[model samples]
Target chain A: MKSFLSLLIAFVAINTELFAAEAGMPQLDPTYWASQAFWLILVFTILYISISKFYLPKIKDNLDNRENKIKEDLENANKFKEESEAKLKEYDLILENAKKEVLKIHFESKSTLDKDIQSKKESMEKEIEKEILKAQKEISELKKNSISSIQIISGSIVSNIIENISGDKLNESSIKATVEDVSKKNMNKFL
Target chain B: MQQFTVQRIGPEINIVGVDLSFTNASLFMVISAAVIMLFLFLGSKEKKVIPNKLQLIAEMSYTFVAKMISDTAGSKARPYFPFIFSLFMFVLFCNMVGMLPYSFTVTSHIIVTLIMALFIFIAVTIIGFIKHGFKYLSIFVPSGVPAVLLPLITIIEIISYLSRPVSLSVRLFANMMAGHTMLKVFGGFVVSLGILGGWLPLSFSVALTGLEILVAFLQAYVFAILTCIYLNDALNLHH
Candidate 1:
């Protein structure tokens, strides 16, 4: 502001002297300063108004448009970064879930195998017990028949032996029946 | 009926009695435009790291605007370099051309300055709207003010904001026009003096011319920097 004032004063001083010297007669009009001031103010006001209304606005807009474009680009970049981060997080979760699921399947399969092995062993033990019981029952039945045959044959054999040695006692009907029974039983066994 | 009047030096052109005023203003504008184009076209070719004649001028302009945008508006405002740079070049060329003898300064006229200022004003306003939407109106409301003072302060701020174009245009037109008119009157003295006692006005004219050159540069810079500030306002719109 001071510089502007100084320049104005300097210009006036120089022009005043030059105008006076050139005229080769008298001093410049006393109203000269006033006239110049008025015109300067007028011209200045007109220019100020025009520029404020038209040119400045256009120039300002062009500058701002560029800034807005840059800002928009930055915002888009930030959005992309966030999306990528979110996708990465999702992938990590998916990978973790996949690993846990694999572990679960492995454990379930191992338990199932254990149960199958236990059941198979129990069934085999039951089958072996049933076979042992059947063998015992058969053995017992054979013993029962053997006992009866032994009882009858023992009496008959003793009587035969005594008779052959002494040649004294004749064979009784009951003894013969017993000997027949014993011999029959023994023949059946042999057959 | 004594109808005898000697009219010397007829106009170079007259059309339809309206005078077809392609005045000194039009002439200087054309000259400025031509000179600027010539200088720019001849200065650079395909651009070089090591500039040739025209390239040197173009490179200087580019760097000047680049520095201005970065410095005043920060790197965020770098994209406006071309527009601001072009403005400087055009104005500077106009100013320099005006300094030539018998040449009119186009920018010294209110019409041209007003157009330039109006463009910047509108541009900034548009940017503010686009960036902030309706929220940009908040710029009219000061940040730290009482509720009761809001209306009054807001009105002042609005008026001041509206004054941007006027202030910008006036500053340029006033400086350029006032300076040139002064130069012209003194220049006439130098001519009329006929090489005797012409030394006085001649010396003053030379000094004034030098000062005018500086003023030319300063005014263009002021215009451009103010544009950058307005751009900052639009982008941020700080209350």
Candidate 2:
């Protein structure tokens, strides 16, 4: 440090002596060094204080705030998007269930209608069979009565014809018996 | 010579044999400081998410210096950010202000730059000693050197280390002073040559002016980055 100070003094002395005649380069003049250093220190100190204390912190805060705001917005957007996606999924599920419900109802109604139609058809067929049976019974009875009446008519006619031709009358029971025998032998051929 | 003159602004102020009078140099320093403060004040006034042009410039400058420090000195240099930032901006503004007609260039003066460089050198040296104690002296010695050549290499390293402040200060001062002198010389040529022959020197002057502006910014950048490097060396002692 002592050597450095001596060197600086020597350098300053040499410069002053050399440039004394021409006033020298103003930068090398030793007279202004003190004030320059002083003001430099003063101005620099103020600058440092103002910058660190006021400017940088404010700028940093702004940047931090902007970053935080952007982050929050992104998170919110993501959350909303997720919610919407979930809602969409829920909507789809609801639609699918509604569709399934519709199909089930349609199938159930169709099955019920088919069952009702089948039962009605069966009851109608049974009623028609019963009516047919009853009709068949009545027809058989009529047939029997008609056959007996025919037998009686034929016997009476036979008796009338005999009486007219031979002047002799047959008894009723014998005539009926003769008619029944004739009818029984020729029924299949005549019918 | 008049460009570098340090004329006294107010009355002479001598406190205990020291001439501490404010000068034009002091005024310009204040102006530089005020301009920086105003710019920052304007930039930070609104604090908008979407920055205006002024704010963008301010923020970009801050980020630029921050990135420079981080890139050169790493995160450990974060605490000294304001000092380096002020130094850079002060030098940069001084150089830029000097570019204007009739404005004084502060960094062009060897005294101003030398003082700053010395301060950085002293501070960095002290920090190294504080952090690493006697081990800080090891920076002057190269590891894995041949025993015979180690002394020579150590001497060379010490010389280089001692020369850091001189080199740093001279580089900035010389660049500013030389560039401005060249500009002035060309300007003189343009004026002396009249309209017919003036065009050449005038054009050269124009180009030189542009170069000087770039140099102005570059010198400030070099100044700050070198400080960071020095800080890096101090904080992280390397052989």
Candidate 3:
């Protein structure tokens, strides 16, 4: 409160004197020019030193740092892009190799299965042919046997019929010889 | 007019017969300088990658002055950036501070502006002489001019060159002083005219105050830009 009071007093005192002055042209007052100029010089020098030494450099550093950071970020982005591109290429190559490998395995398995099937089919056909040939031979043999039996039966019947009808019996030796001769002739015809 | 008067704040001291009294003008000058210093110091403290408002203002002012110097004086004037920057800030602050009610305008005084202008003029002249030697005088002799009119042209050129500091200082001091005086005069009218009649002058005073603000900024810019131009002429020796 005392300080504020003194300040008010000082202000009044200063204004009182300021009012007493004629107020014609303050700029033309030669008495104050020297002091104003001196103060100006002193204050300006101090300001210049402070600005040049400290303030300006800090602002400059901020700008330079931003520039460098941007440059670094750009470089990093470029590097990441290249790396991803390389990875994509590698992935494509691996995928292509896998596809080729799969195709090769498929073809190899197919060929092996075909060969196995073909061999199995060929063996089955050979077995069927052998069985057919054996059955054919048996049929031919049965036909030959049946034909002989039929001839023998027919000769016996003829002999009986001749013996009954004539009432006098022929000689057994002759009959037998005749039958043998006839049967021989008949076998030669059939054969 | 009373506002323009310089009041001594304390006891007057005589140094080698020179009266160096701490006056209102000195106080205001010191205040302006301190304000500039504090503003810059606080504004630049953070140094963030992404700047806040204060930092942005600080940075803007820095670039503003930098661009002004480069535009007017080119790269050769880079070495004198501190002086030019100081002058601009000081003048700009003084002008701005004067806008506050009952505050002193340091730039209103011819001596202050004269000192600054004279210093710039002398410094630039010294630089020109040192760099170009006696050939610096050839600036007065235009190449296309006939020899018959050479003397007249030379004299005119010398006069014009000598008038640079006078015009530079007077331009700032007069503008500031005149604007403040007009404001004071209008303010007086407003007080004397009473409530009903005061409104018109009050409105005019408002308008004039806005104009004065613009003039304040422009005068500072003109002062700094003119300094840069003069510096350019000296440094580059432009024909």
Candidate 4:
């Protein structure tokens, strides 16, 4: 506090002295040079110290802070970018593996289905072939039965006509023999 | 003419036959220094990432001086950046303040510029001697000179080497004083002449004022750049 007052007093005194100095051409006047030099040295020294001490450091700090922040931000961005790229690669890898799995499943299912269809077709064909053979055998049997019955009926009719015309019954054995002979002779033509 | 005067503002003190009265020149020098201090201090107080107007100006000035030092004196002269920056700002402020009507032009005086130049000259010479020792004398002896003409070249080199401070100070002081005086003379003519006749001198004064402002900035730049060059010569001893 005491120093402050003294400084104030000194400031006023210096200013008063400056106001009292004679006005003239500064080049011709050598008297004021000393005062000017003294004040300049004092003021300049203070200014230089203040600037170096108080001012430049702040500016340097600001600049350094800005540069450091930018660098840190860039580093962070790069780190995140790398992380995201790695994640994307992992995602792509997983998708590729899933697609391969799906393809394998599809092919496995398709082959299984093709095998089932082939086995079913072979079984159905076998059943149809058996039914066709049975039907053919039955038709041949029916034809044979019908033909034998017709032969029997024709023999009976002939025997009855012979009895009516002669008024005497012919012997069964002879008739039978006659019938067989006749049938034998005309077999090729009739059949 | 009135702007060049240095009036004493307080009681005169005579110490060992030297007049040490605080004068208007002293006051303005202090003002210039104070203004610089305030500007820098206020500008850098916040230090925002996206700088405000004041901060931008502070940053620009900082980079500007740093660039100037590096350009003129190379990276080795980085240590003297504060001194060179201070000199530039001080001179610039003084010249600009002088451009204000009725304000004193500190740079217009030979004494102030001379003192600054002499300091630079002495500092550079001392640095040269300290760094290179007696080998520093080799600067005066040019390379590839014929044996017969060596002495003559050395003498001329010495004279030119000694004149650095004089030329440096005079260049600034003369430019500021002459430019201000011309502006004042033209302004006087404008006032003395009637309205119809005054337009010519007034227009010239306006143009001269604009030119003087440019010169003020240029002189400050010249002063700082020359100091850097001298510092470069001292540190590097470039022949």
Q: Which model scores highest in lDDT?
A: 2
Tens-place lDDT digits, model 2, residues B1-239:
56888999879999999999989999999999999999999988997888999988988998899999999989999999988998999999999999999999988999899999999999999999998999999998888999999999999999999999999999999999999878876776666556766677789999999999999999999999999999999998766
- Which residue pairs clash in candidate 2? none
Off by over 4 Å in 3: A1-23, A113-191
DockQ pick, better of 2 and 4: 2
lDDT by residue (tens digit), candidate 2, A44-128:
8899999989899888788788889999999999999999999999999999999999999999999999999999999999999
Residue-level lDDT tens digits of model 4 in B45-80: 896889999988988888899899998889889889
Tens digit of per-residue lDDT, candidate 3, span A1-191: 58655654564465446545754687787987778878888888888898888888888888788789889999999999999999999999999999999999999999999999999999999999999999988888986886667656765666678878986766666766676677777866765
lDDT of candidate 1 at residue B108, scale 0 to 100: 66
TM-score of chain A of each: 0.40, 0.48, 0.49, 0.45
Question: What value does DockQ give for candidate 1?
Answer: 0.01
Expressed as tens digits, the lDDT of each residue in A76-159 for candidate 4 is 999999999999999999999999999999999999999999999999999999999999889878766755665566667767
Q: What are the per-residue Cα lDDT tens digits for candidate 1 across A81-152?
A: 999999999999999999999999999999999999999989999999999999988888887787667656
Ranking by lDDT: 2, 3, 4, 1
Model 4 error, position A88 (Å): 3.4
Candidate 3 chain B, run of 10 with poorest lDDT: B188-197
The total of clashing pairs for model 4 equals 15
Model 4 alpha-carbon drift over 4 Å, by segment: A1-24, A108-191, B14-17
| C-alpha lDDT values of all predictions | 0.68, 0.89, 0.86, 0.85
Q: Give the TM-score of candidate 3.
A: 0.77
Q: In DockQ, how does model 4 score against the reference complex? A: 0.27
Weakest lDDT window of 10 consecutive positions for candidate 1 chain A? A25-34
Off by over 4 Å in 2: A1-23, A114-191
User: What DockQ does every candidate get?
Assistant: 0.01, 0.31, 0.32, 0.27
Global Cα lDDT for candidate 3: 0.86
Candidate 4 achieves a global lDDT of: 0.85
